[model samples]
Every structure is written in structure tokens, then in C-alpha cells.
Target: MLSKRVVSCFDVRDGKLVKSVKFVNTKEIGEVVGRARQYYEDGLDELVMYDITASSDHRDIMLETVEAVASEIFIPFSVGGGIRSVEDATDLRWAGAEKINVNTAAVDRPELISEISHAVGAQSTILSIDVLRVPGGPLPSGFEIVTHGGRTHTGIDAIEWAREGERRGAGEIVVNSIDADGTCDGYDVELTRTVVDAVGIPVIASGGAGKPEHLYDVLTEGGADAALVASMVHYGEYTVSELKQYLHERGVKVRMHY
Candidate 1:
């Protein structure tokens, strides 16, 4: 197995960093550029930035802000939200985003995933899924896709969508749990495992990251290639290096030489 990744997430709204629980009640936490640079200097393996309200507000992504933040970091990071076409993905890439993450747009038009992936190699295209468990659903796994920033449930089985994403050329999948967002309890292991099992590409387990133990659990038992953390680092509770060191001590392979 490859070394597990410690990915930091920055949920941005109006060019500021924000955090929310269960995808609601969001509040600004910091400036996007400063925080991105801090995490990069602290040696985070990767970063994921979402323009949290772009889709819900029916607006384009914050390109200038994306460029400013991108200029501050050197590692691979994804820019998401309101990306509706290959043109948008190209713009994001030009703005310095290493990858493009599609959630609501990809759901509304599944073909967008392949279109962007075809335009800019599959490795640069990612499918970001906001998912939740719906009891008595068609999926035996019980996880369904939620869009519009988790406001609308699509009833689409997450497992199946992840499989389809891989077939359509998505190089990676980030499975974010609505039940766990900002809860900081832990990632939804079952939800992550289901997608990991169904997809051939890397699966990043997002949401509900409380501490290093949580990262370890998701990367090992949850079968995720990486764990996306926010609150634990955003609130000054821990630094990226400290978390990676903790994971390393616990026998989880992490890129620790930096």
C-alpha cells in the first residue's frame, strides 16, 4: 500500500476561510492565502479548497482568490465549487490549481467529469461527493449523494456514482460525509470504505476529523488513501507536522522526511 496522506481542507466563502458543522452555520476563520501558506510550510501532503457558496449562490468561482491562494502554496491542491465546464477547469488550472474538484456540477451533468478529465488528464480531475446514509435506500450500502452543498439529497447511490466516476476517467474521489462535517468526531468509516471498494482510484475520506487517531483510523480501517482535516488544524489544536508525526508513530506510513 502507498503511504497514507494527510490532506488539509480549506472551506472558503467570499475569500475567507470558514468552518461549519454538518454543512451549516459556517463562520469565517482566517484569510485563505495566509492559511494556505501556513499549511504548505507545515508540510501538509495536499490541500482541498472549496468555494463553499459558489454553487448555492449561482456564481462562478472566486478566480482571483484562487490565484492568490495558489500562489502561496506549492503542493497539490484542488479548487472546487461552481465549476460547470472544461473551460472553468482550464481557468482553475491556469490560476495554479493542480487539480479540479467537481461536486454539484458533476452531479447535474455527469459528463462534465469525463469532459474535464479528457481535457486535462484524468489525474487532474477529481470527483468530490457529499454523501449521507439514507436508511431503506436502493443502495445496499445505504449511502446516497447530496448536492447543492448538502442541501439536496439526490437519492443517487454514492457507491455507484464513485464507480461511474472511475469509469468516466476521474482519477480520484473525495467522499465527504454530511453526517460528520465539522463534527470532528471522526470520519464515516463505512461510508468511505464503500466508495473505496467500489472505485479503482484513490479515495479521500473527508469530514469529521478530530485528531490524529481519527486520521489513522480512516486511512487504515476505513480504507482511505487520505484523510481531510479542518477543525483540528484550523483552531490551532494541532499543526500538520505534529499530526503526521503522530500518525507515523502509530505505524501509519506517511511522507515524513520533509
Candidate 2:
């Protein structure tokens, strides 16, 4: 098996790193650059910074904040939110973002995925889907896509969206369960596995990662290429190195050399 990744996520609002429960009740945690540097120093494999209010508020992503955090972390850094065009994605790349994540805009116009892949390499385009479980919904997977930081329901079947994203040339997919986000109970392994099986590309499981066991479950049972962590690390519940060590000792392949 390939080495599994432990990614630290920064949900930034007004240039401050904040976290929320189920995409609500957001609380500011700390500065983005400082926390990012700390995580990188703690052996984080990658970092994802989302301007959480950018798309919802209809504003551009905070480039200055992105640049600040990007300058401090040597690991791969991904920036998302308010990306609507190739120029926006290219601008983020110029601002030192290693990858560009898109959600609201991509759902509104699926062709943007191809447009971005053509302008930038497919490897740099990440399709981030925020999903909510609806048991009796009009979808086979019983899951639907939510956009604008989990404010609007798109009625797009989560499983089908994953397949379509792969077809449109997204190199990776981030399946963030809105219901599981910030709860820290555990990752929605079932939701993640559904998407992973539907897509041939790499899948990253996000939301509800509370401890090393949660990460392990998602990486193994969920068949995810990586796990995105927030609350567990943000609140000092665990460090990136600690989580990696836990996984490594359990026979899960993870990067030991930071």
C-alpha cells in the first residue's frame, strides 16, 4: 500500500483560522500562518486552507493570508473558496498554492473543472465536495452535496458527483461530510468509501477526525488516500507526528521523515 497522508486543514475566516461544528457555531482558534508553521514542523504531509466565507460572502479568497501561510510551510499547500475561473485558479497558483480546490463554482458549472485542468495540470485541481447524509433523499447513495460552506443543498448525488468529477479531470477528491465535520466522533467512513469506490482518482477523507484511530479507520476501511484533520489538531488533542507515529506503529505506511 502507498504511504497514507495526514493533512492539516485551516478554515480561515477574516484572515483568522477558525473551526466549526457541523459547519456552524464557528470559533476562531488562532493565526493561520503560525498554526500552519506549527503543523508543518510537527510533520504534517500537506496543508489545506479554505477561505470559508469567500464563496458564501461573494468575495475573493484572501490571497495575503494564503501567501503568508504558504510561505511558512514547505509541504504541499492547497487553497480553496471563491475560485470561479481559470484566472482565479492561476492567481492562487501564483500566490503559492500548490493545488486549487473548488466547490460552489464547480457545481454551478461543471465545465470549469475541465477548464482548470486544461489551464493548470489535472494534478493541481482538487474537487472538494461537502456532503450531508439524507437517508430518505432522492439519491441512491442517500447523500447530497452542500455548497457555500454547507449552507445550500445542491441535490447532487454525492456518489455520482465523485464519478463525474473524475471524468472531468480532477486529480483528487475531498469528501467532507458536513454532518461529521467538527464533531470529532469519527470520519464518515461509509460516505468516504462510497466516493472512493466510485472514483478512480485519489480520495481524501475530511471531517470528524478526532484521534489516530479515526484516521486509521478512514485510511483503511474508507480506502482513502489521505485524511484531513482539523479539530483534533487545532485544539491540541494530537500532533501530526503523534498521529503518524500511531498509524506507523500499527503497520500503516506513513512518512516518518519530515
Candidate 3:
């Protein structure tokens, strides 16, 4: 099995790190650059910085903020929000982002995924799918792909979209659960497993990571390559080193903290 990776997420809005429930009622936490620098120094494997409201507001990601955070962190970083075309992806790479994550834009034009992947190697593109479950069993409350920062539903089956994304050349897929986001209960394991089974690419599970044990559960039981965490890490509730230590002790393969 591949070693589980610890990825820290910074949900930026108006150039600040903000935490909110289900993408609403956001409260500012701190500056994005400072927190990103701290995590990079603390041995995080990678960083995911997102302008949470950019797609909803129909604006480009704050390149100035991206450049500032990029200069401070040495690890691989992925930036997303309002990334609509091959040019957008190329500009983000030029601005120092290692990968470009596309959500709303991809949903609006599925072909863009393939176009960006072809323009800038598939490895440089990430398909970020925000999902919500509708209560219905026989269907397993199956995934619904959401866009525009969870404000709009694309009416596409999440699993099918993930499969198509892989076929379209997306190097990776980020499955973010809208219902479980910021709840701190745990990841929606079933939701992750379903997507993982549907696609052959790396699936990074996001949202609802509350504790070290939760991380463990998702990596092992949930079968995810990596997990993206925000609230737990941003609020000082858990440290990257501590979580890695616990995972290592549990016999889960992870980069050991020095």
C-alpha cells in the first residue's frame, strides 16, 4: 500500500483563512501565508490553498496571495477557484502553483478537464468534485456533484463524473463531502469508498476530519490515498506532527516526523 499523505487545506476568502460549516457562516481565522508557512515547516506533505468564494463570486483566484504563499512554502502546492480554461491553469502554474484544481469550471464544461490536462500534462491538473448525499437507500444516498462552492448542483452522478474525469485525463480527483464539511464528526467513509471504487486515479478525501483516529479510519477503512484537513488543523485542535506520529504508531505507512 502507498504511504498515506497528510495534506493541509487553507480555505481563503477575501485573502484570509476562514472556517465555516457547509461553506456558510464563515469566520476569519488568520492570514493564509502565515498558516501555510507554519504547516510547510511542520512537515506537511503538501498544501492546498483555495479561494473558497472565487467561483461563487465569478472572480479569479488571488494570484498575489498565491504568490506570497508559494514563496513561503517549499512543498508541493495546489491552487483552485475560478479556474476555467487551459490559460487559467497555465497562469496558475506560472504563478508558482504546482497543480491546478478545477471544480465549478469543470462541471460547467467537462471538456475543459481534458483540454487543461492536454495543455499542461495531466499531472498538473486536479479535478475537485464537491458532493452531497440525498437520503435514499437503494441508491445509497449516492453522490451528487456540486459546483460554485457548493451553491449549485450539476445534477450529475458523482461516481460517473469521477470515472469520466479519469477518462478525460485528470491526474487526480479530490472528493469533498459538503454534508460532512466542518462537522468534525469524521469523513463520510462510504462516500469515499464508492468514488474510489469507480475511478483508477488518486482520490483525496476532504471535509469532516476531526481527529487523528478519523484520519486513520479514512486512510485504512475508507481506502483513500490522502486526506485534506482544514478546521481541525487551522483551529489548533491538532498538529500535523502529532497526527503523523499517531498514524505511524498504528502501523500505517506515513512520512515520519523528524
lDDT (CA) per prediction: 0.87, 0.88, 0.85
Poorest stretch of ten by lDDT in candidate 3: 52-61
TM-score of each: 0.94, 0.94, 0.92
| Residue pairs that clash (backbone atoms under 3 angstroms), model 3 | none
- lDDT digits (tens) for residues 28-99 of candidate 2: 999888888988888999998888774444334477787777788888988887789999899889888989
* TM-score, structure 3 vs. true: 0.92
C-alpha lDDT of candidate 3 relative to the true structure: 0.85
Q: Top model by lDDT, which number?
A: 2
Q: Per-residue alpha-carbon lDDT of model 3 for 1-258, expressed as tens digits?
A: 567889988878877888778767889999989888888877798888777764444344477778888899888899887788888788778888999998888888899999999988889789999998866633334678877557887778888889899999999989999888878999989999888888888889998899999889888888999988888888898899888888999999998853
What's model 1's TM-score?
Answer: 0.94
